[model samples]
Target chain A: MKKFLAITLVLALVVLGVAAKVKPIKLGAVLPLGDITGRQAANAMKLAVKEINAAGGVLGRPLELIIVDDEMNPSKGAAAIDKLATIDKVDFFIGGMSSGVHLAQIPILKKYQKITVWIGAASHLCEKALAGADWYFHLHPWDYQQGAGYAIGWKQILEKYPQVKFDRVFLAYEEGAFGTASYKAYLAMLEQAKQGEGPYVGLVKEFKGESFKSAAFGGGDYRAVLRLAKEWNPDAFIWAGYDADALPMMAQAKEIGFAPPIFIGAPPGWPADFGKSPLSEGVVLYGMWAPSLNKVSPVAEHFYNAYVKEFGEEPATYFAPLGYTNVYFLVEGIKKAGTLEKEALIKALEQVEYESPLGETLKIAPSAVIKHQGFTTQKILQWQNGKQEVIWPFEVQTAEFIYPFPKWEGR
Target chain B: MKKLGMLIILAVVALGFLFPLYAGPYPLHVMTTVLTYMALGLSWDMMLRTGQLSFGTAGFFGLGSYAALLTTLYLGLNPLASIFVGGVFAAIVAFALGYAILRLREIYFAITTLALAGVFTVVARNLHDFTGGPEGKILPSAIFNGDPTKVYWLTFSVALGSILVSELFQRTRIRFAITAIRNDEITAKSSGIDIFKYLLFVFVITSAIQGVVGGAYAQQYGFVSPESAFSTNFLLLPIAMCLAGGIYSTLGPVIGSVILGVLSEYLKLRFPYGHLIIYGVIIVAIVLFMPHGILGMLKKIAQKTRTEVGGNENEK
Candidate 1:
């Protein structure tokens, strides 16, 4: 019996030794995690990691994905980055669900020299990178692109869908850094058009009839302001804000029965079945990488199919594709580098061209004005007949922009 | 007993100074956070002793962070100099504000401090050009030089300084005045404790410490947004640490900080999902079992052990 116990202990030690010998490569993700979007990102990453392991993990070892919740705050995000860099000693870091979180991780990334990928669209995040450093890469449309995309779509409506007739519009945007930057960019684009400073503006605004009024509101107490805006009854009510400000305003718009011809702007509630809500009918949102887009790549289709199969439903948030793409990008970079070394991975990341859900052959250009991210094919999606459809960027548009939105009562 | 306590504290400080020797950069980073929170706990205890339940840790913390960032951005001072500037800024603000707001007793004072926190958030958001508004500011990369170990030592010193301040406060006549007020304000006022003056003094000291802690936080993290700097974690964690360890004592906050800090890191690693819920449950258990705190429970255990030993001796 004593010999039996001794052999069992030795066997257990041997198993432990073998397990320790097979060190898994860790992929660390920093996200808000509490929010639905953040949770979806985590879930999607988990699915990708599972598939990668099943297919025989990287470097003959299983992959371990560690998620740290930044809670959308920069300081916490920085702390999370520190843990990933130092404690967990993760081989690669993928994050930047928010621009602030991404920005916070920059200094630490410099310290660790770990290859970092940012998926947030905060325009200035990567732009602030030191001129020569090439260790970091970014994906996702910058706020400038998002703003410009909406403007171009609006221009398309102005020229093509003359029946919509958007003369006098009302713009309501949250007064945070994001909303302010995007709104200012939009205004500058319009002002450039007003002066014919840019080539596309004069041809688009034929009558200078593009008159609009705008108001900046705080994050809280949107109902009263929305009611006041409702009283004005403009041609279109364009609201640009985050989920917090946008969600409340959307619910209150339903309460006040303030439906305009075009309800267009940034995402508030989300890709999360906003179409199913009676209040969200005909509302358009500016976003990056929608599944509803027409120019779908085979890689994107495979991702969507896998996502639906694993999640048992279509992704409620657009983050699933983003999360999946981030993993694949890192995996592809590693494969190209032919080693797990940070410098090699970073060099490969710079030259990486992968089939992302957003674009075919999605590539990153290091240290330009756009700074590490370039993909012009962002999608502006609208809810039409209880389904979200891509409506902008003429080549990949799945459906026409539904202007002259049906009234809340009628819907 | 007092000598033993001091010896333990000194030994801990000495070991803390040597923490980076063995711990990796990640552990050092987490230790820096633990020290920052421990300092916050000590500072919070200072105010609680003055018979005020101030909920303005986040306010002063955010204020200090902005003050340091603006001073460095505009004045081009060293980060260390900026930390002092932040502390001075917080002290001046607290001294002036306490004159008006310190008169309110108990719940009113608590509510006022809570409102002041909201005021800080709005002010930070509005000061776009200076504070970088909601996005906040990241210290220039030159500021930190990317040394987590050095930052950990700096935070350890700041945290140790806060404990020393708490110890010094307890030793002074100010402690007697504050203790009297905490026990019974009207009686203490009758005994000429000068309630407002004592409260204001404690408020200034605590605010200054909190400001320095915030500056240290911004320096270490290298970034601070209005939301991150003014995070309720600054308010909640320190308060929880103080209460869980044992309020109105120097070692309580220290013990509490270490326990909670380690537990929090462990939970963050082990249970990322609903960890907040798990954390809440642990706090509830601590409050229930160790009503006075961990120190109180320790004291009880010590006394019980002594009794059991004496009883055994007598039986023999």
Candidate 2:
């Protein structure tokens, strides 16, 4: 009995040792899984992973996902990437929701020299790689492109509000790199447009002493900030921020009677399915491609159908498309690279030019912006009645822009 | 006896300093955050020493982080200078607020501090002029420049410095006055101890320490949002660590931080959202089973053993 037991123990030890040596394809998912954006990104990624594994997996080896929670924090996001790279021994990383989180992980990703496929970082600066980081690949549309789309919509609103002829546009953005860059782009564009346009001055206000560099709300109530805006009496309020902030700010602005003719917001809160917040209607939101609306491409139908069949909900927001496009393109890159090896994967990713569910074929760029395709730009959507409708980039117009907010008379 | 204790502590400190070098990335990150909590816990105890319970450590922490983040982002200040500036800002704010609120005793003091933290959070969220509001701020890469190992070293050094400062305060006449105040504030005041001055001094100094640690933490983590900085987790964990380690003593916070910090990491990994429950259970059990704390229990055991040995020697 002792001899048999010893043999069994030896067999178990050998099996355990062999199991440890069997290296699986390690793919890391760095997400804000506990928060709203993270939850959506994680769920979408899980769905993609499930579909991939079912479809014979990547490189004949089952793909394993090691998700690290960024907790919607930039430092945590970087730390999550560090853990994924050093501890999990992942081959590559894919995920990000909050722009702050993405910007935080950029330097770390650069240091580690890992191929990171950004799922939802709208910051054009991160996409540009001012520091010249090549390993970082952004799958989502750049906010600058979205800002331009917003400018197009703003052009119409400005024309509509010609009678209101006012100066000073208040720019309130999140203090991260993404928000700062977007704000700069928006400000520059507005400045050029508002040039010599009669008392049309601009007052860029952030909190006292601290500039809008580090995502501080600048140290006062949104109502107080709005009151300051009321004091300034800007022609409009151009807020480039995510859902977590925009909803409450709008509520507070309404409370304090700072109703501008236009209130424009960015991705996180601008989705048509922003069901959680009561301030869902009337605010003009700019987001990346929503699978439900961006059905111009044939791939959208297949993706939309598959997503609905699997998840039991329509793909109303960009979460599904972002996840689907990232995984689909990543897998395509893996296939093109011809191996699951890191260098091969990166090489393949660089060579990628595949049609995504969002209708555009994503091409990897030699420049910092990894995905170089025409569709890798943002679109403007407005919350009319109860749902978001694509209004800008007139070519793909699902709906027309509702001119003048609050007392908006025309659609 | 002091020399022996110092030498033993030196060895432990060296180990604490060196472990990050050999540890895996995950463990190193956990240890870094542990050091952050250790600094927070010690500072909290220092304030409590003056018989003032502050619920605004998170507020000061949030403010310090913003100060560091803002300086680094806009002014392009050096990392060390940013941390110092953040600490100074927090200390000044604490000094002003402590003067106004320190007159109230016990729960009022606690509630007032809690209200102060809420005000800071509200300001952080809505102001949108300085802070990013709900989106939070992204710290610049210039601080430690994305080197996790270097950041770990920074945290260790800061934690050590905070501990030494706390020890110095403990051994001072100020500490004796604080003790007298905690035991009997009226008597402490009657004995020529200006209660308000000491209270404000302790509050400001402790807030400065928390701010420094908070600044270091913000840079180390590379992001600061109102929610993450002012989260109840930050406030609760440090208090739990100080109380569990045996509050009012230097060793208690240090030891408590080590245990709870490690346990919090493990629980977070295993249970994710459910770990808070496990954390509450462990804390409740510890508070119930050993009211004086593990260290105090160990001292009692040692004294009893020594007494038994002396009696045995007499019998022999």
Candidate 3:
């Protein structure tokens, strides 16, 4: 009995010593893991951590990713972030895919003063994060850049076709920060082009004052708005919102004859899966980066290929690039910082100017207003035969533009 | 027997008060959420006593969130004081609403309250200018400068107060009155028990306490939206905890909340996608195996042991 006890004790001590050998750098991701977008983000983060660990990890310590489900809801996000910061004592944060979730997480982030990288776009999230602390590092391109880019693409299209003038442009956006900001920026772009010194003039005939409609974020049954939009007889209609509204908008718009000549949406509203629907044909959208373009960079190619190998499928969302790169930005920041200290990490993140997977030098603005929102230069794409094809930034254009949306004929 | 129970209560509270001293931020936050469930379970149990099935915890919770948030924002009151005001505001609304809805019988009452909660969500969504619309309002400052220790104590105090109130009610003559109403409303009415009056009184008090819980929620997390405030989890989780803990008793709710709360956190960790599924399974299991809850089963065992021991002594 004494001999057996001695052997067991020796074995226990060996196990404990071996366990102590590994010092892990804990990282937390707050995402709606149940939802496809969040699940993709979580998978991408896990893949990145695995790769980093295989590459001898960060500062000789293995990177540990702690993922918490936010349920794509604000309260749950705040609670999850609280758990990440307070309970787990995470070294960093790479999360907030939904603007609602990000907005909820802002206060907790400020309280913890942890270095966080953004994966969600609602420019207001940046504004809120910046207002609270200097530790927030946003990677997602803001609504202004994407909205203006879409407007410029529309301008180029209009300038190319002389007779195709957008006499009336109607804007219907969800009342959340992303939609609201993008709508305003697009409106400002129309006004700017009209007022600017350009050979690209006479594209916008008139900007109606009351054309902007702000839909409640969670309101269902959009048939009333469809009726109003059809009656207005708009040459161009802009639908700015998230996927929830966007999915129904496609079905409901086709249900009524509300198809305008020119239709464009902001990033997430144009989900890759939406192309599966026949109603998705001819809908133009803008994004920070698309793997479909593939010409973004070699880093983009590598990330896409790795995701396919790890997950056994193509990433069907634009958020994968943003989610995958957000972790790398944090890892790069940690490398630059050299130490795990909060102040050092914050300073290093602020100074980060790494070439991202999207082939752009990811960096933050100096001010709180647009801090870390420098991932501009979005691509304009249109859906053709259930496949989204890049049609703008002429250098990256894989396909030509399809002008004047055709009406639903005998569908 | 009373002294022993009181001593145990005191001991548990003393441990709870010392929780932050040893715990880190995450455990403290989780415990704070547990306290929230405790208060929710206890408050729901209070209403359940009077044969009233109200599915309007979300309605009152949402109303309290807006009330507290608006009070702090516009009135510029302190968070604690704002929470008090919010609770009172919810109680007032409940009083008025109970005048109409508490007269409902069985499923009608439950359905009405559920519909009322939905109505609160819609009203909060549409009233954008006031309640910050659907996006929710992040308070300019948190209660106690976002101190986890302080937040834990505050939530603990509220939950403790609710549990004591529940125990006190169980001890009082109001218990028999409510029990009579629950057992048979027609018989109780024949015997001069004012059914609506008793129901309204219990509903108002339970709702007032629940409102305080909502106010604490707004102050703690520092934000509340229509969706956040009116999440069905608020309604369902408490009911599940109460039923699983053994309904209509203080001991039942206390045990129920702790087990369900810890189980939920564990399941969330174990299977993030299926936590809701796990929660449903737990409720079903509790209903099937232990219809009377863990406390009821324990009570039965304890009684049996006492009877057998007494019989042994008699035999000797």
Locate the minimum summed-lDDT window of 10 residues in model 3 chain A. A208-217
Q: Best to worst by TM-score, what's the order?
A: 1, 3, 2
What does DockQ give for each predicted structure? 0.38, 0.24, 0.27
Give the alpha carbon lDDT tens digit for every residue of A56-98 in model 1. 8876778899999876765567778878877788888886677
How many steric overlaps does candidate 2 have? 20
Per-residue lDDT value at A73 in model 3: 59
Q: Which residue ranges in model 2 land beyond 4 Å of their true spot?
A: A1-22, A123-130, A153-186, A195-267, A270-284, A289-291, A294-298, A308-317, A339-347, A364-376, A382-411, B1-8, B62-78, B81-140, B218-236, B272-316
Please report the candidate that would top DockQ against the real structure: 1
Predicted candidate 3 versus true structure: per-residue lDDT over B1-316, tens digit per residue: 9999879978988999999999877677778887887888898899888887888887887788778878898788899998887789889999999999988989999899889877887688667668766566777667786787898999999899898889888999889889999999999999998888889888888888888989998887676777678888788888888888899999898898889878877788889878878778878999799999989999999999999999999999
Clashing pairs in model 1?
none
Q: What's model 2's lDDT at B198?
A: 86
Model 3: DockQ vs. true structure: 0.27
Return the candidate ranking by lDDT, descending: 3, 1, 2
List iRMS for all predictions: 2.6, 5.1, 3.5
Write down the lDDT that model 1 would get. 0.75
Q: Rank the candidates by DockQ, best first.
A: 1, 3, 2
Score chain B of candidate 2 by TM-score.
Answer: 0.95
After best superposition, candidate 1 residue B190: deviation in angstroms? 2.3
| Model number with the top lDDT | 3
